[model samples]
Target: MAPMGIRLSPLGVAVFCLLGVGVFYHLYAGVISSRIATFRQKKTVDLRELLALSIEASVQGGREVKRIREDDSLQEKTKGKTKEGASEKLTLGDLNSHRKMFYLFKNTYPFLQVNSEEHDSSDGEATIWTPNIPVDVLNKVPASQMVPSESVTVWIDPLDATQEYTENLPKYVTTMVCVAVDGEPVIGVIHKPFTGHTAWGFVGQGANVAPRESYNANNPKVIVSRSHSGKVKAFVQQAFGNSTEIIPAGGAGYKVLALLDPSDDEKPDVYIHVTYIKKWDICAGNAILKALGGHMTTLKGEEIDYSGSEGNPGGLLASVGMDHKKLVSRLPPWDQNK
Candidate 1:
């Protein structure tokens, strides 16, 4: 397992995340063009440039997502329902957003592997375009602390909370990107499209977030998904006592952000997922949480590995200002089939 207490640096996040995509039909359309291979002087490139591409892609793609919703062109399709009967869905938001991030990287590196939830990855066109390197980020996280390009995996979730979005709950929607090095997420950016708010962090560097204030370990307030609340609710009530407060919300990104919400009534001390979840759904939040000196792991307290594939079957438990293992040990082993 990776070490605990990894930090998130705001400067590090700005350098890497601020990720982008589609506003110009083609990959390099919107911004002034710059070649991304600044360090390919015989085969070595800086991690900062790749992160810049992600940031620009995420920013532009976020605008497209908000525009799609504003135009009422969701093109929604039923993906069945969650176990508790909430709708499972897909929309143009998911497809287009995935493509935006993919094109930004594939067009430049051509061979770089990016993990996503959508299936329309055909590599239709390749264009060489990327944002200029973020110098401010380099000044924060020097080269010595970063991993090589070959060891990185970028996980992008174009639109999270599709179900909430369809239900006219735009407040919960977000676009996210995570860069994991050697199976540990080193950087992440979570962009809320409707509000144009983006929060990002690079592990061990520090975060733009503040310490939590609403946690009462003896009677913690926890957040879980509206659709997947039964098991998680039971676990929290059991582990933290029946008096523990449980807040049901949508979107993994939203839940993770809530852990740092400044409002007393809105902030949740913990976020938990009771079943198998896709890597794209939780990877960015994990990276951000880790960067904040927090923990996000399975019920057994093992860290989630973000090296490819979509599913994590061990379940999840995340907290920002508390002992993650102490919380984990309080719960009895949960049945996966329950």
Candidate 2:
């Protein structure tokens, strides 16, 4: 006998080999997916961590502003200068001592990137910025690198309404974070450190309207920047004139939220504004607003595109209610006096 020749079924051998390959491929895919998921989780954690750090930096800015307001020595340097001319005297270089804290906290993060609207960002980016507004961390963030599932652009006016901050307005200054996706806000967080109060809105995610003390529904309120004035007040007066009460608050982020929520007992139906600002000013906050089932657009009801050049500035008209069309019709465009 020839050592009893052994026979194996070709089909069975082939099936076993295929099964082995399938198992290996499945494991390889699982590992890859797992790694991707882990990366996303870590990124999210990092963003939140960054948010906390930003809050710290914002607080520092607030303190600096307060000192400017309280310091007779510093105020004397800027005494002759009007609030409009305050920036001439105020320089980031002068705040080097104060800004060091921001630098220190900023360096701790490995993936930190400048928000395009940073004062030092390219001229095109900064051109859109309104005077006296501090670009928050999100303003410098590159659009290409945001979280994948939900694209976001954040506006961090670390010291929003800076003029007020420098003018001795207690708690008039604030730190803001507006989260927007493709031009709509999905979530937003605004903190008034002076009051130790926080307000958050997550579209469809249920808003907490934090700062328990800040939550009220009796008298609706609207916040506005301390320095810039005109169309916002006119629109409010014409829209709500006798029907609703208008409470003017300072800070764009704060104002936007005021319409979403009011510290008074009643909430306003709409928040409207017409001004020249860049994508960095409202992108993040708009994301949060959109998430809350609201909409923001130009007075013409056209969507504001972030891709435009700085010269083509876009203004906003946001509404928690869909009453923007009526309001738009009633008010004149920024260029035209209605």
Candidate 3:
């Protein structure tokens, strides 16, 4: 009303300001969410590229080392004594040229801030860009139920099949795993260096390949680790009987992939491992298999808890399109304490 121009009361102006703030917040949140999704997708692709490059470099020729004992620094860091306090070892296999390739990839990305301590070779300048999105915001899981970031884990097996990789069997080698939140694997990425195939998924979000196979089977085709076959062979024989077709495979992730996408010659129905297997070996594969209507658990039928030390003391069993309880019943007695 002043000078015949539009005028607003103080309350009206306040209301307008609030509306403006609300719009900005909505827009900002959308942008952040988009960025996070893009970042994840990019990381998966980049990881596959790095693995491929490493494989090629190794083929060109490099010295191979084996059974190298962990130095004090590596042992202490792996034992959860460091500030990172993550109870998982970076690499389990012997230090070799392929493993060196892993270090090259890890140093190149450094997106995993948790591995900052291990990045001492990176000029002590690891860029830290930890995502702060609340769990409830990312998924349907409620924030109150979400585990703290410190407790939220990221399990990684940079080169899953070391024996296969060193032997020039690139088909069996893979760059495996990433991101488990609150002991539940939330994000997983598995890359086959030889095939240039990558499969990734997040919990609740269906995988690239949806579940379609039926679990009903008389004699299931089983996959056992080629390197660690003794215990698994016995367990498979006992659980599924000798009639079950046993196929020895290399990488844990590769075995899961075989179950996910079976070839004409080798159609895997179950993956059973009864010996000491690390968390990194299974987390990525577990996440993908779960997405494909499959289940992975301890032989005792308990869900594998990812919070503890790297070693899976109870052994691991994975089945595609089958009742977990029924599979558990078939197994011999399991003593987790052992």
The candidate that achieves the highest lDDT relative to the unseen native structure: 1
Stretches of candidate 1 exceeding 4 Å from the true structure: 1-45, 79-87, 121-128, 133-139, 142-146
User: How displaced is residue 198 in candidate 2, in Å?
Assistant: 2.6
Error at 240, model 1, angstroms: 1.0
Residue 56 of model 3, lDDT score: 34
lDDT of 2 by residue, 115-201 (tens): 432343222211111113123333432222335333434444445554555455645555555444444544455656566555555
TM-score order of candidates, best first?
A: 1, 3, 2
Write one digit per residue (lDDT tens) for candidate 1, span 213-279. Answer: 6476666788998887876777888888888888999999999998887864667888888887888
Q: What is the lDDT, from 0 to 100, of the residue 113 in candidate 3?
A: 25
Whole-structure CA lDDT of model 3: 0.59
- Measured by TM-score, the strongest candidate is 1
Error of 1 at 249 (Å): 0.6
Please, what is the TM-score per model? 0.81, 0.55, 0.61
